[model samples]
Target: MTFAISKTASQIAPFRVMKILAQAKALQAQGRDIIHMEIGEPDFASPSCVHQAAQNAAEQGLTHYTATLGLPALREKLAQFYDGFYHAKVNAEQLVITPGSSSALQLVLTAILNPGEQVLMADPTYPCNRQFVHLLHGEVYSVPVTADSQYQLTLDHLKQHWNPQIKAVMVASPANPTGTLIEQAELLKMAQFLAQRDTYFIVDEIYQGLVYERPAESILAHQNLPQNVVVINSFSKFFGMTGWRLGWCVVPEHLIDVLDRLGQNLYLSAPTLSQYGALAVLESDALTELEQRRQIFQQRRNRLYAAMQSAGFTLKTLPQGAFYLYWDVSEYTQDSERFCAALLQQTGVAITPGTDFGKEAGKSHVRLAYTNDRIEEAVQRIQGFVEQYR
Candidate 1:
């Protein structure tokens, strides 16, 4: 007898970057020296303070499940963090802790969308976002974004795409793949527009602390954060706590109870020890250490950006934040998936294909993450690979 699979499960595409990573590991097991440039994970370890905190929690036997909404103390600390870091007035009552930002996205989408409603986002977005919408049986309306707009959605895009079926708009700042940011003024305007239409506005700020050009700001930085706005962030990228799987979000007060109930039903609670570690990292010295790591990432970004351009790659935009550089490889190959596969197989350099991000312009593009410490050597390998085609 054959088991039936739901169409939603069947239609969901695999995250191609992880597939590349798995293949790279397989090669590594055979003694191949792989230089990873594919995944968007920080190379730095979590701060000593965070480790100490987690150890203390374990020693004290604080392993039981916290509240479904997470530890009240952690929530309160995050509120203080927003107040001090972004000067954004966030009440502790408005925040909810989740296993990761991915779970936060799932919660927010589940709460807002009815079956068949739509979410409007840029075409080349974080691939999992579209999948999250699909998991909820919601539709996605992707607006094609080009380098002309810095690979971000503008108010005009929203205005043109708005339909009665569109229930929310989701976007990321210091966006994945491109590492571009939506201008603050434009973000505000879009938020106001969505608020007027009674549509939810979800902003992904998981890469907020990795910005290079200027101090990072949040949507909550606006004097009065529009009630329609929901901000999602993670400790994974900024604090080097990816393995801990801790993240939080700030939502409107009215949705707090809804999220709390959902949280109770979903996973019950986030990891208790991880929450304790997160609480420790919110302190001043830990933040300063993370800031120094950000500087190191900026240095790597600068080196890789110049080297790739010197290698005759077309980098349309100078990534302002995040560790990714999405470059056009159309000059040599239109098939980014094949290009990435060949690059990994031939040179032991792993990078993500544009197809993993979206269909529009994906075949012509590829995303290289600067998270690996051996980036200089990776650059040399990539340069040699490009020369073979040239």
Candidate 2:
């Protein structure tokens, strides 16, 4: 007898990048040379300091459960991080550590949304966000964003799309796929508007430290942060700690207890060893090492950007942060998924189809991650593939 699947489980779309990655691995196992440009994980290992810290924790028998809200010292360090990095004043009391930014997002959405309440976010966003909302039986209202706005949501977009059903507005800086940022003035305007409507503003800052052109700032930089604002961040990206499965979120003071209780039940606590490692990375030496890696990523971005443009790919916006280039592949194929699969099979170059992100403009686009060190080789392969179509 077949078991029935829940609607949430059935309707949640698969993250297509992982599928492509699996296929890419299959080819690699068969001795095919694959140039990976699909996954967003940084190629670098976690800082030496973090490694040392984790070892120390393990040796000291610090593997026991931490407070559900996380180690007080780690939370306090993150608060100081905001002050030193963004000149933003954050209270340690407002922070909650979780297994990953994914968990942080889950807690925030669960705390604020009732079933059927809506979340407004840009289309072509990180694919999992809509799934997160769907998991809670909430609705996602996607606003189609384009290159004209640098693929970011503007205050005007929010004003036009606002509806009574929308309980929250979520956006990411150095956003996934596109690697673009929301303009600061526009972000501020949108935040104030949401505050007036008693709606929550959720900012995803997982890629905060990898910015290229400008210094990254937290929304808390505002002298008076709105009570409804929530900021989610992680050690996964810039800190090169993806495997550590650690992240944190800063919420309004009023929601601290709600998140603490929710975290206690849902996660019990983030990984204790990972928490200790995170503490080491927050120090000045580790930060300096991360900065050097940022420069390397910037260099990779520059090299790949020019090569892709030279290969006749249409890149509408130069990525400001993160390590992705969402380029239009419509000139070659209208079906990005098919294009990606064929490209992988034929050229052994793996990249993600835009369909993984959203419906609008997805078929015409593809996202290439520059996270791997083989970018130059990948572009050489991509150039040859494009030339065949041309």
Candidate 3:
């Protein structure tokens, strides 16, 4: 007998970058020299303080399952972090620790969305957001945002796309691929508008600490935030703790009990050792080191932006935050998927095709992460590839 897979499983698109990464790894196994710019993981290890804390936790046998909500101390530390960093008064009760921002997002959507409900977001987003919506049997309404609006959904855009079906509006600040941020005033206006309509507003602040030229602001910074407003953040990007897989979300007080119940069933709790380790991440010395690393990332962004332009790649927006450069490769190829695959095979440089984000405007684009130490080498390889292919 034959069995049928779930429709949701069928609708999920494969992460094309991972496929390129696999090929790159295969080439590397064959002794090929590959410069990776495809994946968005930071190359740095967790700070020494965090590593020490993890070691101590292990020695002390703090490996047992923490409370479903989280270790009380870690939750309190995160709550205080918001007050100190963003000037937002987030009580410990408002925070939920999840395995990662990915899982946090899933739990948030699961807690809020019913079947056939919809969430509106910009096209060419982080890719997983739409997939999570699909997994929950909800619809994703992707608004096509351009560089003019900094690839962000404006209040006017939200108004234009407003319908009873749109249950929530999700956006990433210093957004993935584009690395553009929504101004605080615009965010406030959106909050007010959504509040008036009783619609949910979810901001993905995964890259908050990675912003440049402007201070990182949290949606929680707004004292009058709508009851439905939620913020998701992770240690993966800024703290260089990707493998630790720990992240937290700030939810409305009313949904705390619901999420508590959901968290109980999720993974029991985020990794206990990681939580203990993350406690040291917010220390003054660790933050100073992290700030220095941020400067390095900013420099890499500058170097790549200039190099990509010199290589004849069209860049519409300069990245202000995060460590990604999204380029319009229309001059080279209309099919970004083919362009990426061929570039990897020929030059041994792996990059992400924009098609992985969305098919609309993403067809003529590619996203390169500046997370590697060999930015100059990657630049040279890309320039040579463009000279040959274009």
> Candidate 3 at 329: error in angstroms?
0.7
RMSD of model 3, in Å?
Answer: 1.3
> Which lDDT tens digits does candidate 2 get at residues 101-122?
9999999999999999999999
lDDT for model 1, on a 0 to 1 scale? 0.92
Best by the lDDT measure: 1
- Looking at model 1, the pairs that clash are none
Candidate 1 lDDT score at position 173: 96
- lDDT per residue for candidate 3 within 84-192, as digits (tens), equals 8899899998899999899899999999898899999998899999999999999999999888898889999988998888888999998998898988888888877
RMSD of each: 1.0, 1.1, 1.3
Looking at model 1, report the run of 10 residues with the lowest lDDT sum: 306-315
**Candidate 2 — which residues are off by over 4 angstroms?**
none
TM-score of each: 0.98, 0.98, 0.97
User: In angstroms, how far off is 216's CA in candidate 2?
Assistant: 1.8
Clashes of 2: 0
